[model samples]
Target chain A: MKHTLSVLVQNKPGVLARTAGLFSRRGYNIESLTVGVTENENVSRMTIVVTGDDTVVEQVTKQLNKLIEVIKVSDLTKESYVDRELVLIKVTADGSNRGEIMQLVDVFRARIVDVAAKSLIVEVTGDEEKIVALIAMLKQFGIKEIVRTGTLALGRGPKVIQSGKD
Target chain B: MNLTGAKALIKSLEYEHVDTIFGIPGGVVIPIYDELYQQDAITHYLVRHEQAAAHAADGYARATGKVGVCMATSGPGATNLVTGIATAYMDSVPMIAITGQVTTDLIGNDAFQEANITGITQPVTKHNYLLHDASEIPQTIKEAFHIASTGRPGPVLIDIPKDVQTMTAPFDYPKKVHLPGYQPTYEGHPGQIKRAAKAISEAHRPVIYVGGGVKISGASEEVRALAETILAPVTMTLMGMGTMPADHPLSLGMLGMHGTRYANYAVTESDLIIAIGARFDDRVTGKIASFAPNAKIIHIDIDPAEIGKNVRVDIPIVGDVKRVLQKLMPMLKQTRTKEWMEKVHTWKREYPLEFEVTGLRPQYVVREISRLCPDAVVCTEVGQHQMWAAQYFSHRHPRNFISSGGLGTMGYGFPASIGAKIGRPDETVFDLAGDGSFTMNCQELATAVAYDVQVKVAIFNNGYLGMVRQWQELFYDRRYSQTKLSEINFVKLADAFGAHGIRVDSASEVAPAIKEALAVPKPVIIDFRIEPEECVWPMVPAGAALNEIIDAKSGKV
Candidate 1:
């Protein structure tokens, strides 16, 4: 099972390493992780995707909460939430296949961010399934290179993961 | 008031009311030492080694329930404290370790005597800091102390650069700490407490399993009260030895590997296990699937992660042990089970702890010491002697028996005894040590002598690392590789260090030597020559279930 956790921690030096080190030392498998400052400059939010059973994931959440810098941990996997990952794919393009690639990108609502003589860089943002589908479709055109940002998540509606003080 | 960062550090310690420090001076720590020399509020004990300093601080914390503090220079000095820090971390002892680091600019340049201490201690410490500015001294020190001594107390380190120590800063100690992420749950949930109380009241064969958390939370009285009120037997883990009186009728002594047979049996047969302040460690829960298979476990610990880390927990209450016990006490109904008590008593009578009385046995030495100094604080170094001490010595007060329960550090007892004596000067202190373990930090005899610390050490002088040899004899075809330890004349070594020394080779001479050593005003070491191959009995072979115990008489499960 996969659990996406939203962790709020103090914006201090080595916070990332401390959080990452825990996952490695405890043998928890991390699928994807993204960290950035939240609305409050003093606090940072880490969106981590981990794979474990219910018991192991519960232990992981509890262990993450034990770190002194981690203010709060919210598992958004079960909740009604929104998640997105931005990926840029460079596909081999020629006069014949360029139109098909552009047409395919339009259908997925993706943009051709960069164009070169031999490749076209398509930028797309969606959930994991959509990104995987886009990459699979672009594979026919031959993906020259690809880069991806880790999965970022947030709860739906008005609910939010706050540090109580904020 | 404006002061140097080093002075600010000392001032912050004074604000925390720290009366003593265990530390060694080094190049990077010279500025801190210079400031320490000018202070009258805190007395610093110059230990022979950095590791001993940390262990001594840990002993002091265990004995006094205060946050222990140790300091060392960077690089080698800081690295030496790693084992002691890990030891304290594993046992959840409240400790602050201050290490001097190289200048901030040279931190990543590999300057001489520089080390990334905070990075090195990340896993072992509850939290750590690497201060680049002198102004952060007061706040960092306060936070370090608060974090170290709070819920699930553990070691915290502050690595201060040399230039930061020399920098000037305003000395203003914060009266309150604002750590958003570090608040611990001190109160148990009302619904969970009710459930636990209901389970306890209805349990016919209930057992209370206690751990070091009881001592750390100062819940010894509460634990005893709960057991007595419920008419339940109490079994303590090794770290929880002194939390309940060993002579109490309900007391089942220790449980787990090398634990009393009755304690293990009672737990194995228990219908309800009210585990207070205890994590179901592998040693305590051998063959986890079969450990207390019939019992409904109620685990109460300050650390939530410990609740179901091992065995399945029925009711988990994440709160301080003392507070949780208090909340649950009012909801409980006193009940008795005469049949269950009788069964436990039968097992106790059948499997009483015993050893041969023919030779100068290590058990005999520990038993004699317990008989002579009933109120004395006992510490033990790792190996066979540690298990023997745990088995033979009767503890009646919290913090009275301090040993390396978790990490099982080899040379913990001797230096720890020095700190224990310093913390509680009125009580007699003894380090029940092995020849191999004691030799690791015997150099601390100089610190003990110089400070007039009257700590008595009883060295069970067996020629081999007896515990490892026992494992080999039992399971490894008696291939005792690298277990033999060359003997040293401890009496001469003690004399050389300006401490009293005595050697006793016979069982008849043990008591008299202990008495003589007690009367001596300074540190004393007694070398008791015993049977070399004597193994700690009542053994549960590694990975064996608690019920599969091998007794000395039967030599079989």
Candidate 2:
């Protein structure tokens, strides 16, 4: 089972390493992890996508909560959440296929961020499913290179994972 | 008055009511040591090795329920404290470790005596900090102590560079730290407590499974109350010894691998298991799939993470054990488990913990020591002697038996005894060590004599690492391998360190030697020559089920 966890932690040196160390030590496979500064300068939020069974996910969440730097851990998979993955794909394109590639990019709601002699850098942003579909369509065009920012997530609607003092 | 960072650190420790610290000073931490010299409020015990310093602090913390403090220099000194810090962390002992870093400018420059102690100890510590500004010393120290001593206790580290120690800052200790992320839940949920109490009252065969948390939370009395009220047999983990008096009718000696036959039997047959202050460690759960197969479990612990980490529970209460027990005890209705109690007693009678009394045995030595110093705080290094102490020795009070339960660190006993003695100077402290384990950090004998910390040590000199030897004999067709030890004159080694030493080869000599060692107002080491082939009985092989325990004498499973 794939589980997405939104972890809020104190923005201090080594906190990220400590949190990551827990996963490696427990041998839990982390599919994707993205850490960034939060609204509060002293706090940071991490979006981690982990693949494990129920027991493994429970242990991971509990262990994360044990870290003193960690403020809150919520299984975003259990709730209605919005997840986004950003990908920059460089696809091989020549004069013959350039127009068709642009048309496909438009169909996928992506944009040509950069243009080169034989390739077009297409920037795509969407949920994992949509991004995967776009990548499948672009792979037919011979992908020159691909880079992705791992999934980042937030709960939908009025459900807020508060970080401030309760 | 403008004070240096060292002075601010000292003031913060003073505010925490810390009276003693253990450490070995070096170049990077000289400024802090100098400040320590000018103060009389806290006494510093100069340990021979930085490792011993950390172990001693751990021992003190476990014995006295106070946050143990240890200090060390940069690089090697800081690295040496890793094992001890990890030991404390594994056992949930409250400890504060302060290390000196190279000057701020030379931190990442690969200068002499420069190591990133905070980064090195990140996984091992509950929390850690590296101070860049002198003004943060007092607050950081305050936070470190609070974090180390609160909730599920663990070691916390603070690494300060030499420049920060010399820099001047006003000392202002915070009245109360405002850590929004670190509040520990102390009270159990009312519904959960009610459900747990109802289960206990309704259980036909109930068992109270306790652990080190009982001692940490000061819940021994509450555990007793709950057990007596519900007529449940109490089985404790190795670290949970002394939570229930060994002689009590309801008490079953330590459970799991190498646990007493009756205790393991009771756990196997119980219909309801009330686990308190204990994480179901692998050592205590021989083959988790078969552990308490028929029982409905109720787990109570201060740390929420420990509740269902290892075992599933029907009712889980996340709160301090003592507090939760107090509430649950009052709500629990008395149960009539006469038939269940009688069945447990029959098992106890059928399989009592015993060993042959023909030759000099480590079990005999531990028994004799227990007879002589029952009230003394006892600690043990890992191996056969540690299990023997846990099995044979009767602990009557909480915090009376201390050992490296989680990590099972070998060389833990000697230094831990030093810390235990310093924490309670009026009480007697003993470390039961194996010959193999005693050699790991015997240099700490020098630290004991230097500080006049009178900690008695009894080494079971079987001439081999007996635990490993036992495993080899049982499973590996007796290969022996690296388990054998070369002979050493332990008496001379003790004498060289300005401490007393004795050698006993016969059973009759054991009592007299213990008496003599007790009378001596210095650290004493007694080497008892025992049979090398003697193994701990009622063995449950690793990965085997709890019910499949093998009897040593009859070879029956």
Candidate 3:
């Protein structure tokens, strides 16, 4: 089964590499990982989607807690949380396809943020599944370019997660 | 006290009383090395290769019972130490490896010689880190050292980028580390200790199956004392070779595959087996169900995972061996079992390790070498000869013999002996190796010569990868395949490094050749060309019990 782990780490040069390195070294397949600074200036939250057995995930959590830079890790799949991903899809937008694409974007609650003479840029913000669905639809218009912020997560309420809090 | 992270790191090491640091300097690691320079605490040994530095550090740690330290730069330098770190990890050597990383900004840009070292080393190390704040450096170093040296000791890496290392920070070195997940139990429970004593007093045929725990727990003396007081025969796993003096009445040589005839008999016949500090590796215990079938086993280890990893424990003591032994020593009763002693003695006489030496037997040469240099530290690489030395050599003290037992690493002997010699300068050290095993790390002969370390190397040259050849002869229908190795004159190879060398083709030449080398004031090599098809006998084939050893002397299984 696939699970998304959102890790809050001290913002440092090697922290992300260390995270990626841990996954690869332990033979944990990281399908996708996105990291960026949090509202807190000193901390960076990274969302990583990985597939493994329950035991392996537990081992991974314990191992991650052992690293000094990692401040916290939460298996967001277990929590009442929100995971979001943003993707900018640039598709050819000649007069023929622009109107039809804009109608589909409205139906999906996404917006066409940029438009040039030959292409249109669609900005979509949703969970990974929603983003993936929009990306697949835009591919029909002959997508010229695409970039995705993999996944970002936040826990519900006032609850805070700490690494090795146990 | 105000101190740099580097200074705090050195001070923490000083608290641990680390005597030496092995590493190569680089820009990223210079700040730490500078702090190392400021202290008169631990002397640093500049090794040519980072990998060698790591291995040397491991060797020093394994030999001296102290935490070994090594440092290197980020990227390739840190990557080079991977094999050495893995070697230590696999063998359970305590080590702290520090690496310098690219500065804060350049870290992820794939800048000049910069790579994520903590990430790279994460899986290989028992624990690892990437330092973000300079203030956390001192505590991280302490935590790394704590994790590395405590419980079942293993390697840990701390990667500090150049920016973090140089950044001035208030370093408060904590005396005690408080990691709930990492607290290692170092003493057995009182109830378990009492049960162990009860089993010992009640056992009709008791035997102590000792392993590396005796050394790692620093319990060799305690184990010896307990064995003597209880009057139980002791058999050691290969890793436990030097835990008890070989000449002691309680010592039953080594007890496993290719173990001595008597030692295997004792283990098989014993009703109660007390195993300490030895994990039940497949090589040591064949067919787990049938091993020590009639015996009740009491296993003690620091790591809880290892308790039931192999065999079901009848009484498990999860703690450090030394501390457990100390706790149990008071509970042990004064007793003697003359019947158990005599029964084992009968097995010894009936089935002694004997081979006719009409010509040059490697067994005879090992015995001769031991007799000539009884006090010299004898180290062996894993194989038939390693087993041969274990069977033949009369070790007079604990911690005097060293070899790669847990991992069964081939290239460990030469470097391990060099490290051992450096620690114990008063004693001459010899690394007894097969030609194949010798060549695995023969490059280290230069290390010996360069360090002005005269570690005597004795190679049993059989013109093949001797161990595999023995198996092929016995089991593979004599299909040699690639087991026949290259014919390299190792003596000439030793000479090319500006060292002394000798070759012994005859049995009579063995003693005189060693005498000549021992007389010389420099390191020397002696290659003994023995019978090629000779196999280490009293062999328990894979998937056989200790009692089922193949006795080649009788030409029968």
lDDT, each prediction: 0.93, 0.91, 0.81
Chain A (alone) TM-scores for all candidate structures: 0.98, 0.97, 0.89
Residue pairs in steric clash, candidate 1? none
* Per-prediction TM-score to the true structure, in the order listed: 0.98, 0.98, 0.77
lDDT of 1: 0.93
Model 2, CA-based lDDT:
0.91
Chain B alone, TM-score, model 3: 0.92
Error of 3 at B51 (Å): 3.0
Candidate 2 is graded, for docking, as: medium
Best by lDDT: 1
Q: Can you give the lDDT of residue A136 in candidate 3?
A: 86
Q: Mind giving the per-residue lDDT tens digits that candidate 1 earns over B1-557?
A: 88889999998999999989999999999999999898799999999999999999999999999999999999999999999999999999999999999999899998999989998999999999999999999999899999999999999999999999998987888888889998999999989999999998889999999999999999999999998888899999999998888888899999999999999999999999999999988888888988998999999999999989998899999999999999998888787678999999899889889999998998999989999999999999998999898888988888899999889999999999999999999999999999999999999999999999999999999988888988888888889999999869888999999999999999999999999999998899999999998888898877988999987665522
Better candidate number, 1 or 2, judged by DockQ: 1
Q: What is the DockQ score of candidate 1, to 2 decimals? A: 0.76
Docking class of 1: medium
Model 2 misplaced stretches (Cα beyond 4 Å)? B554-557
